[model samples]
Target: MRTRGSLFRILGLCLLAGALVAGTLLPVVALAGVVTNEASETVESLSAELADEPPPLVTTITDRNGDPVATLYDQYRIPTAAEEISDAMKWALISVEDRRFYEHHGVDWKGTVRAALNNTSGGDTQGASTLTQQYVKNYLINVIYRNDKAGQQRAQETSITRKLAEARIAIQLETTMSKDEILVGYLNVVEFSRQVYGVGAAARSYFGTTPDKLTVAQGALLAGMANNPSIYDPWSHPERALERRDFVIDKMVENRKLSEEDAERVKDEPLGVLPDGPDKPAANCVGAGPENGFFCQYVEDYLLEHGMKKDDLYTGGYTIRTTMDPVANHAAKESAEQQVDKTEENVANTLSLVKPGKDRHEVVALAANRDYGPDAAAGQTEFALPSAISNVTGTGSSYKVFTAAAAMERGVAGIHDTVQSPSRHVSDVFVGGGEQCPTVARGTRAYCVTNASEGGSGSMTLQTALQTSPNTAFVILEEQAGMRAVLDMANRLGMRKTMASNAATGGAPDPDAESAEARQSQLEFFGPSENSPGKGSFTLGVSPTSGLELANVAATILSGGVWCPPTPIGEITDRDGKPRPLQEEQCEQAVPEGLANTLAVGMSKDDLPGGTAHAAAQGVGWNRPMIGKTGTTQHNGSAAFVGGTPQLAGAAMVFRPDRPYGGLVDGGPGNVRATDGDSGNMFGGKTPARTWFGAVSKILEGQEVLPLPAADPRYERVN
Candidate 1:
């Protein structure tokens, strides 16, 4: 109102003041808050990661007999990561994922800025995750910051919220951990799926190597996968995985982690992986002994029952200096495999034989043939061995040897003791009202006859009866020894208990619904028992004994009463390679050396002229001496050859093919044939003896075979 100039100046001043106010207030209200590089410091904290408990693993070991084997374990888990992580792998990881991993605190600022700008310009959401964020997400917790109200709600509501809580926690982690420790924790906590957790496990699963052995390229590939595991799975997405790997190579070069030339070459390298699924210890091969799988399993079970831990097998790095000779085990398994192969075409059944020894036992052979299934036919199940833990039952004839040995030990019988065969029977009957039958009778008087019962082996003495394996003769002698003497003798030989636990339990009826059980229930081979000592069948080898038990008994004879517990394992060491001390071991000497020598001498005499083991005797190379025994069961079920040299002793057995068919698995007439033709005349002397000879010949280093220290005080044989 005062004038035109004054009015204009006032208006200008007002506009200027308003502009100043807008500028000052706009900056204050539009402030995006502090952005001083929200990078993590070394003082970061973190939540405790969940520790993984792995699966339970089992291990096993065995004797040549394929008996209850031994076992080993480490936390019952095969820790893939613990075995795989190494320094080489660490370097490779850095080379691929974060070359400046050690130099940077928790973020690569330049990388983050460029990524954020690109996302903003493109109107899309992307990430600039550094190694620290990746580790935090995978191991510590997830990190999520967003702009929407719902997003804010989510940040405060879910595990992601908990994860944010963890960021606060992780920021404190740096205070408690070193850089290397954090990295290790990251590697250990990361998951590669398939129940495999940790870089160590991934190394083994993917590359068949430990972290230390990881190739530069391999490390890069593995590290790169942590960004997106499913999309980069090499096994499932080879092409995509390779492309991702090449991208890593390019990034590595961009960051100067690798020279350009090296990077280019690595990018072009074709991806390859091991054909086998993964690399690990073969549990099927325990103690890494010569025996096959079945025998190993047997030994494993026995050891476990005897106080050996299951974990000691794998991680224990046990130096199982076994009593078994590898060469012998191989031979026995091979021979048995061949025989069983030819005999069984429907199911797999193998035989494993062991020869007892003074220094180390010998494996005669492990035999399995395809009579079970396609797997068996393919040789996959031979060592996989069927769990025959319950299939124990045989005749009682084997008990006679024990009876004879016991009588000798008890001073109740001697080599000179003679009992007329075919005479009136006088054996003790365990059941009600015993019968009085005559000895195997000749025309008018009883005379000893061989087990064959074809003709009289002549009026042979008691020792001669043992040498000739005369069934009639032993029966008559047992009668004379009296029931108490025979029973007492059998008990001492360790045949007091039934082989099958079911038989030992109550004389219960068969609960097995399987047809095989129904059929087996009717046979003596099933080993049905009403009492400890049955009334009549004790004369014949009618008691079930494992190949191991048989070998032990024969070993007792060979060792002259010294029952050396068969040694299958010798040494165990810790992860640090320190040897583990074992508890003191003690063994019981079950018989006198004199009595044992008598059994050995009597058995060895079979290697002489006109003995039941004449075939075995012929194989001994007339230049040296040998001792052996042959037993053929009724119905052609089992044929056995138990024998040894001065330094070694062993036994072999072959199940005849004449077994009646039970089911599709019974391996009927058309099932398959044993390597040896299933001729009616087949005997243990043929296959078992030959296999035993093959194994022993290798261990003996061509040494002369000798008998036990002579039992004949009157007649001495040179040692």
Candidate 2:
């Protein structure tokens, strides 16, 4: 009475059932029958292709104290082992999805025959997939074909080939893995809702609990969602979800896994989910909050730049422990914001700190007054203002430290050696003929430089020049030390990014199509040729510079001339808890240790009387022995302060971020200009120095005070 199509469908199902049965018992001989041979081959081929690929999982990023900073993931999943799942959850899943899960060799032949007969007789569509078979199906769609639309479609299609493939893989899995293992794998791989995968993530998302802590009702609810997460989503369709949940409980009772009395009681309970629904992990760096977001982004970028694949960071389930000190970072953020309101339109304040060591220079904090987010109109930005070289501007006289180190290294001048601090000096060797250096002398143009204050007009010891930061004194010292030496020293002592090609100008210069700005950048930083005499303004810190680089320069001196890359990562581990090696730049002695020690001493008076930062230091009640320097740019466009104790080195910068050429002035809140101006007064000793002191004092509070290394006599006087 059946049609030919129906007869063929029934025949095929019967033959598959027979082959599955025979393969488990009679083995080779049973599958040799002509009708079952093709089915047998398909099963064999699919079993070989079945691989236990790990699912995409969440990657957690934490601070130095092991507190979570952020979490990243492709699919929000946290895989749990069989033992980590509660018995109630396991039983509920088995009861509703597959009652005979323990007894099945994988393909329940009787169920297959029943489904075949019913479908051929024009009844509703039915599936005979066992738990292992469902696991294989979900694995194929979510893992193997995750990125392939066509493959995922084929895996989910209601075709005989797909079902047979699932059956074969399921049978193979049963032969290899225990029932508990297969069941847990299914639970871990299945999707509970959009962007939520596995019971581990599901428990937290739905009920704000863990897998092992699920109650009977919670277990039944989660188990019901595996059938069709979208249709049974508790947040979207509460009534249907509750109905499905109760149905699952009833099934548990029928399967004898739960008592009828318990089922009735649980069915009357409300869907005890979090009022706000799913509590997903924080998304990327912004989730780290404004206080730590900048440091979080730096950590993310540092890892990616150092050979970690983007996919690996999102899905590798890595536990990245960074060097961000919560105390230091909080202090830095509060200090920066306190110095300059985050909503300030024209001016920006930023700070960076590094813990100095001969073997490691851990970046403790990187913070900006601007809130770290995407809402730029609200004065929030995700730009790497504290560390990126592109965000750097003229750091004023902070560059003098490099010139001083170069002079000492070349035996031209020592810390105690006398240098002339003329009010104005015209260079004989270096030429000047640009907007930056337009002062001409005689018929030919000469590079003329002047002191910032009238008091810097007489001869003084190199130590006095460091404290007062006289422009002409360090400029004259730069020439004596040779331009190349100073430039080299800057690069060696943590100005690596600044000395390289301008990242904002599109990397290395191209003579054919280079812009005027790019050409000027090259000339100012690198000069026309390595052999050419350097710019006279070099010692005056006329070039663009980074805050973090300035802090590391101080760190290098504090670490006895050992310059280690400012690293944010403290440790990294894989999902299995194996330590992963980080490719960090090695530390090297950038200058003689004795010279560095003596230079630290020479620079130590900046926070005392007669020094630029003395007022700021005294205002903060700072009495600790520390090395410090303050710098103000030529046009007062930017100001910076760098200082350090034996434990920490840090730098602060206040700049016109919107208009780099526009000058800053006092008389506004926090002693800063509300808007940019043509030319006005703002010094590193004011807002920048105070910001530095504010953060450093809080960071070093309660810690033992440590003394700096003694000044080396070799570099204390001219030899």
Candidate 3:
């Protein structure tokens, strides 16, 4: 074991070496002869390893109007410039931590010698780390070795070697960085408490104010915590923290940073910290609250999918401006909850809205009746109910609009072309109606379809067929347009995700499946297939779909055929305010303008008399010229409504979301059932239509009224 005299000799040699590197002259010149070449080389090597990279900072997300929505961070740090910090804070820190901070190069040799003698004499343990040395130590622990526990421990270990290395790095840093720069860097990197870093964040946390506005007492309390945060935490040990704060104030008085009268006056003041604790902003999308959380989630997903790394999002200090419209989102959320109670188990009502334009389709709102959170017992979930196709069921007859548009595009039929709408019809080419319909001679199971009402039993114009949403009429119309054409039209008109995978399986078919039957089953369920004409029910919307995509489909038609991705990001900038590039808008002409115009006109009568959604439209006193379609799946498993004016488009869906999902039956407010639908009580005209109208009316209240595009005579040809 080393003797006490030998330990003191070693400590003296380390202090002398640090003094020599820091350009300080000490009286102990004889001890310099004891420093070895290996010790000198170690200091040089460790100093060279110091990098000037920035520390992790909070990333802020804002709405279109630049209002803050949420903040994300690995460490709750907000880097502030030297001039932005108040003089009280700098004085408080300097007075308490190091009185000779400006006079010393990096190490205070006199203080080190004093501390060394006091420590060896068994007096109060004292630290002689200068402010610059403290900065070097914290930079190594919080930034360079942030992910390495052992490396952090080594940097913080109570050893002479670690102290020498820190001293050497601090000396080198003073040469390259200005005195104020070094001071600000130290202030920004040091931890004030758990997960809280930087004087900027500390000022806001402890005093509920900005760094430039901190008072003398508040600055003293925060600076005092830098020595031992856990012991001086105002939230946990108020009395001890007050004592520390008073000590700092006395130090300020002694150092001439403040008058004795001012010091005493400030010390007598109460610790004005937030009553609860640090005023940390909520972290991540969940902190965006229930109303805007769904839209926030979609923005996050869009950024990640476009190329942003998860780490970059949390620590890059980026300012992401999203296209969330507060008014529209609030209306949608309130309307959805009015239609369906948020706590109602497994029953969800979701809505999405998109602004229509040829150059950009900005998604402004995504709302669901269920609260966006992580508590299942409280009926809250983080699932992307309005945007994810896998979270929804079939959209029912809302898809007939796609088939009608396909017919108009292919020249197979026109808006005014007469089509046979029988009570029942059997599809000979497509397969699988199991036992309900017999197979034809083509050696394929027949697909049988029937109208939802007895009134759909005569030849009617294609426009009338859409208004009534006759299942058999659209199924026959799909055969005329060719199933492939209808499926392609749906894909081009914003059903990309739905057409890209099998919704029943929630993803693409598994290529490594053990049996061919399993693969075939996955391929044929609710999506396009390779070896077959697309499902005959494609026109009837008997496939799981996303509300955002469905709303975009309306937006596509409103834009006169140009299809643009529903983008949520408005702009992005780096920490220094330089604009950053995002994924370019991908807009394409999916169909001829004339064809889209005529189709929009064909769908215009849906909210008028004799249409499926007429009652819901009348209830809202809606008089704007618009296009709309209503759909309800077989057995009432789900109901949907898609509607739009020239300015905006929206879609709403009501469905059962539990496993082995079943039908939703309407029986007045609380009497609704999710498991049984044999009575066929629910329809798209009820909750789904009401939700769409209620939200859209509020969103479009002040906007200029625009009529639907005029129909092209060519597409209105008589059959």
The candidate 2 region of ten consecutive residues with least summed lDDT is 1-10
Q: Total clashing residue pairs per candidate?
A: 80, 0, 0
Deviation in angstroms for 537 in model 3?
3.0
Per-residue lDDT tens digits of candidate 2, residues 486-558?
8889889888767775523423444555565464443354453553465677777766677888899999999
Per-residue CA lDDT of candidate 1, range 404-452, in tens? Answer: 6645554555666653444233434322222233333332222222346
lDDT of 3 at 253: 92
Pairs of residues clashing in candidate 2: none
Write the number of the candidate with greater TM-score, choosing between 1 and 2. Answer: 2
Candidate 3 residues lying further than 4 Å off, grouped into runs, are 1-52, 109-127, 145-151, 158-161, 237-243, 246-270, 375-379, 440-444, 505-534, 667-680
TM values, all candidates: 0.65, 0.86, 0.86
TM-score of 1: 0.65
In model 2, how large is the Cα lDDT of residue 234?
Answer: 93
- Model 3, backbone clash pairs (residues 3+ apart or across chains), number: 0
